[model samples]
Target chain A: METPLSRTDRTRLGRHAERAGTTRSDLDAVLDQGMVCHLGVVVNGSPRVIPTGYGRIGGTLYLHGSTGASSLAASPSQEVCVTVTHLDGVVLARSVFNHSLNYRSAIIYGVPRPVTDPDEKLAGLRAITERLAPGQWDHARLPTRKELAATTVLALPLTEASVKVRQGPPIDEDEDYALDLWAGVLPVRQVLDAPEPDPRLPPGVPVPPHIARRATPTS
Target chain B: METPLSRTDRTRLGRHAERAGTTRSDLDAVLDQGMVCHLGVVVNGSPRVIPTGYGRIGGTLYLHGSTGASSLAASPSQEVCVTVTHLDGVVLARSVFNHSLNYRSAIIYGVPRPVTDPDEKLAGLRAITERLAPGQWDHARLPTRKELAATTVLALPLTEASVKVRQGPPIDEDEDYALDLWAGVLPVRQVLDAPEPDPRLPPGVPVPPHIARRATPTS
Candidate 1:
């Protein structure tokens, strides 16, 4: 269990301040709830952050990318930052300074190693596919030799990750309570509607249960 | 108008490629919809991307901080890459290689300058405040002279900003199309529910229209 670090442990989120009240379960939940993550790294000394799809299996994160000259895939033992954030809503506070966002996010710091084991690489691919669209792995064409070779998978252990969360309404000074300000959380949520089949489908390809079960609201 | 430059456009959302169009309005819309952005810059000849709040007034972007000795803000004429992305959903394709995300994002490239003019500084701060919480600016405490002196705001003109959008369903290869693959959009939506007032409110503080508006849903 890693508690969220804060600037002063005064409740303000901080780094290296031992305020990291985060749990492995917290990171797992956030990762399971999200598919895309912002991969941050220094490229030739300039911080580059790009959002992309990622899959988590147990204690490791597998990011599938092209081996073809991607700055991310080309890195050699460089420090990387992977962030997954879920926006809960716009926290509308009474004061402008107090205005903040309610969100659940996790930032993982590590040096990813390229996956070279063919068996593990294949398993890694399935994790990513199933994570994105549940029952599609067996339904779709598996990666070919060349295509698999062209793909780059980076496996980053999920250690040293920080999960920071902020929920509820604004907490103002006691005196400001009477300032005639409206304070509350404008809750934000993500919902999935019916899945729209491909327009080019030849017909009669029914939706699978794994994918169909997702047509409702997910927390 | 600036379009985001990267393989993100040409690689992932090829099906919705043309619909991946960007314009000045799109950029502004994204700017208005977001309160925080990932600030990317070369820190000490290496890249470091940090999440920071920014307010964009038309083509000018205002960002301020009080880190005191941030390697990023301290730079005078460094080239910076700023990205504002609103995540739509995690696109879980049937194939690991095909996994993607549905998102609307903007990337701006600029040479930032330290704001010096007093009036411009005031306006920049206001822009930031208003951007974060629309109607709360007038109700909040304005930055004091001492606060202003300690904080530094950088003005990044949107002279080279670009937008990249990925929407709609996953497009698999022709052969894979025939596979009984469960494919479609797990449509990502943001919902804004009723506001929750502060527990300690003194009463008589009504919710403002800006805070009352519902979330904008786009498929």
Candidate 2:
């Protein structure tokens, strides 16, 4: 379990901090809620962060990418820091600097070693697939041996991870209180529009329940 | 003026990219479209990447955080890289490694200097607030000099920025295409919910036009 590095690092507002809470279940809850993540790694002594798809299994984060990918594949041996964030709402404040965001984010720091075992590689791949669009794995084609060989999957134990959160109303200075400014949270969320059926579907292909529900976002 | 670094770095189709068709508007379209960006930098010879809200003015990226914030505030003075990504969708493929995303992303590399000038600092602060939520600056209270003093904002010139994108159907191995599997692009998008009125707005303060129009995301 990870705690705020120090007291100050923990946000002051009790509610906002609770909203930013991290639990064993929160990890799976948010991770199951989204598929893509931003991957940050050091290359040539500089930080390079790229967005990629990742799946979480228990306390391990499984990430897969092209073996030929420039940065991720090139620097396979280095310790990488991976983060996945879902922006829930925009917390508007009375003061510009006080503007805050209601978001759920997970940051993991660990050395990610490339997975070489063939069986583990396939499992890792499936986890990422199902994580993105549930039940799509059975609906879609599975990977071939050669394809799996050519691809790269990395497994990072979610040992050193941190979660920080800020949500709700803005905290402004006392003087700004009497100012005539509109202040509140302008809730921002992701909505799934009517799914556009695949162009070549074999007629009457009903939309799956998972995909349908995912289309409608609850902020 | 940002050039593709190499074949691998370019944002094109039939290649390893996502969200291919999203247009690359001159700096404004991309910058104005999104508020949060991942700032990647090296700390103590290690790569440290963190996500924070930002605003772009002309050709500069302005970022702010508490003066006492750990690591992030101190990073601007050193070499830093910033990536702004607007995710359009998740490209679930027949193969796991081929599983990708559709997004518009900008990567900027440079050395950022802290904003000591009071005027530039003020403007940077406004840009961040407005970028997060349009019309926020006008409605929200502006920052005070003393509060501003407690925050640090850095403006990094966007000279070496590069945009990479991918959108559309997934390309799988020829044989895998015949391997009865479901695979296609599942578009992911962000939406804005109805504005939540402030608790102290004295009830029935009709929402502003900007806020009303943005009830649903245009991005």
Candidate 3:
């Protein structure tokens, strides 16, 4: 059986509360679809939001940075908010008052634990790499012990997370629907273009099928 | 001549400092290209990052939310971090240790002021609308007084901001470049797909050319 998602007071949606969901699967879907997330932490008594890549393994979300960076080095004791957002479409309404974006966003809140165990650290790093490139973990060279020692990885449990989604066409007032104007959704998609090989690469290395397939739009 | 961007100690880049830029144009480019941003604010003594839409006019950035939402309500006093990010490509290196994303991001720090004047509110609303869909404000119905009263609009000066950018292929170590593997970048672009009109519309109302042109990729 799968565990259900719970919202502590921190994760509760304050406004537009109707869009919030508490299911673990909903949290998983949003996490699985995104490659980058904004890590929010308070620095010097002020909030600082940094954009970085993340990967989820089971119920734990892994984020890594230089051991010297303040965001990870100072994250062990305090609470952090990690957010992943996907822009699905632009909702153009008949009135400026009703304009909105169709999007799916997940925000997770928790105090992260430092990953010190070697076994779990490798696995976490693998998940982060594979999430960005599905087959590259096995295709590329794994991290060396020295390299791992220099990096700092933090794991934030997905215990308190909220998913808010706004989709479909804009809802205009009843009177404005009659106005003679264009109204619809301009769908936005993140597509991968053709791969560009490194200039120093050998003459015969062909683009791997795993990377080539991503050239087409997925989701 | 355009005013150059200045960086306060808080806005200075702390890590990967090479990617940071203090030019005001760099800040403008990132903001103009993105439609959605994550607004980080402290709510209930914990950091909360909310994904919302924003618009920029000159040195002021405008954000709006329902008057009942706590994020906008509490934003007047405390500092807020507004981030706009564009994921340019996925950098797949020869080693997992060096895997990174190519992206452009802008982080702005300031205390947002509540816009009280009705004229500035409408102008701000128009800028927000037109930024999302160019020529949209002129094409859509203007907001009514009652609708404007129900929304809360906040403006923050662009003076205290920083832009960080990372681009190009992955940078692998000297030894790892000798490995026999495919290594390159997968360019990611946000493209607009064909527009889907509202089904309830009259049969003959066609999509305006301004909206139709967006069907093709720009930038």
Best-matching candidate per lDDT:
3
lDDT of 1: 0.69
lDDT of 3 by residue, B1-219 (tens): 666677788677887789987688889999999998899998776787888889999999999888988777879878999999999998989988888889999999999989999888888887778778888888888878898999998999999998999998889999998999889899988889999887777788889999999886643
The segments of candidate 3 whose C-alpha lies over 4 angstroms from its true place after superposition are: A217-219, B217-219
Docking class of 2: acceptable
Interface Cα RMSD of candidate 2: 3.4
Which is the winner by DockQ between candidate 1 and candidate 3?
3
**Each model's lDDT:** 0.69, 0.69, 0.87
C-alpha lDDT (0 to 100) for residue B146 of candidate 3: 91
Taken in order, the candidates have interface RMSDs of 3.5, 3.4, 1.6
Which scores better on TM-score, 1 or 3? 3
- Determine the backbone clash count of candidate 2: 14
Candidate 1 residues A129-211, lDDT tens each?
Answer: 77767776776667889889988888988876767777777766555566666777777776777777756665777877877
Docking class of 1: acceptable
Clashes counted in candidate 3 amount to 0
Evaluation by TM-score, superior candidate among 2 and 3: 3
- Give the alpha carbon lDDT tens digit for every residue of B1-219 in model 2: 543332233222334344333333444566778868888776656565677899988778898888876665657657787878888776656565566667777777778889999999989988887888888787766677788888988898766656666666776665566544445666777777777766765555577687677777453
Identify the runs in model 1 with alpha carbons over 4 angstroms from their true place. Answer: A1-19, B1-26, B41-48, B68-79, B89-96, B139-141, B146-150, B215-219
